[model samples]
Target: MDRKEQKSIIEGLLFVSGDEGIYPEQIAKVLEIEGNEVINILEEMQKECEGAHRGLQIVQYAKVYRFATKKEHASYYQKLIDIPTAASLSQAALETLAIVAYRQPITRTEMEEIRGVKTDKALQTLVSHLLIKEMGRAEGPGRPILYGTTKEFLDTFGLKTLDDLPALSEENEQMNEADLFFGSLQEISK
Candidate 1:
């Protein structure tokens, strides 16, 4: 097929796939094109979304990709949408969540050690929010319940996996930015 036709075909496939990102190899096999060509097309499409000409952006996380909105339109988009924005968690919960997210499969005592505070209330709040869960039991004395972030956390953050979270150095800022960016894109898609 001609390049123009190929582009159209690729766009159609991407749209059909929607949030379930297609791998380059899969696109290549389906379209009878080189994997490199598929990569190029995907990159070009992503650039179009991120470029000044388009209102959307593309991001890849854990090998999965999604079309998101540009950060510049955050405020106006917020006014245009009816998204849930009033949930507030206590500082203790936030602290506990951070610990659990980074140090998953950790025991309650380990969490308390990191925060230097009792985690009963924080753990309860996190569990209620469905962000943190008791993954299982530790393999040691007393066999305490291991804590970890849930799949809900991944969906809420628009992540394909835990690896999508960047390195721990700028975790808070990176996480906040990702939430704002993906959250806004979700609103726009709706």
Candidate 2:
């Protein structure tokens, strides 16, 4: 396949495959090309993602070639996404994030059960914003990654640690007061 066509196929397969880190063979099958050809195209793509030309990184250490924001360029994404600050969460994201914070090492399926909605978007947003991360795989059938808040989560909220999060109760306040919410911009926002 042509380079343009191969690049298109790679992006589609990677995005659709989610964080699962799809294999080159899987991408090759989708593109109807020899697996070696897929590998070659991926090599070219990886080079393009390197150094000064990069806003994207083609990562592979986790056993898949998924596109990701280059670490140095991360400060620009809040602008590109048109959010007022570094990142903003939907209410659903906040709710699920709360659950994950209080009950960490939690699975997506378990979070879904608590929130009663498919958490794909919220989880994606949370992960993209670096508020939560994949702790590790569960010991269940799917072996899904457990989710938990990160050090950035603590810093963003001006907390010394996760234990600094405010107490919760049986009451559900519409506008809860907690360390979780902060001013729209902070230390790295400039």
Candidate 3:
């Protein structure tokens, strides 16, 4: 591929890699290009993002390349986070929260398994909104974080306690766990 196409592909790779970032060698392998060429392209992309108009910058941590917000925009980003809104939970975030509400001390991997999609962004949203907090670490490999609902979640939903949550219908054995959780959430909201 051409230089411009390579840059675009690399940018996409970095975006999809998220917090895990991407190694230059991995990018080289994927694009079928030389490692040195990948580095040169990454450096060029990094420089391009350094422009004043760009809100994101390419950062390399421990040889892993990823896109991160510019440090100079921290105040603006903080303001955005601090600002309150009447926005309701997104479907993904709401579903993730419901799963956590019923399944306390759940790990992100477990949530993803239930939802059949990646839960990282939704988990981050719930954590940022203070609806869920890391309860502890699960016992096993990686010691994955266990998430549970916070007090704010209870107050927001106007529940006295976890027991206040509606019980799933035993008659609907065909209903998946996520659907059952969503049903309970709807009943709670009403």
Among these predictions, the greatest lDDT belongs to 3
Query: lDDT per residue, candidate 2, 1-190, as tens digits?
Result: 5689779879777778776778998887788889998888888888877979767777786557787778887778767777657457888887777778777989999998877779999989889889899999999698898999998888766778877666555563334322233222233244
**Higher-TM-score candidate among 1 and 2?**
2
Candidate 2 residue runs with Cα over 4 Å from true position: 1-86, 169-190
**What TM-score, over all chains together, does every model reach?**
0.46, 0.46, 0.51
Candidate 1 lDDT, tens digit per residue, 17-59?
7888667787799899898887788788787676677776666
Candidate 1 segments exceeding 4 Å error: 1-85, 169-190
lDDT agreement of model 3 with the native:
0.90
lDDT, model 1, position 180: 40
Question: Cα lDDT for residue 59, model 2?
Answer: 79
lDDT against the true structure, each candidate: 0.76, 0.77, 0.90
In model 3, which residue pairs have backbone atoms overlapping below 3 Å? none
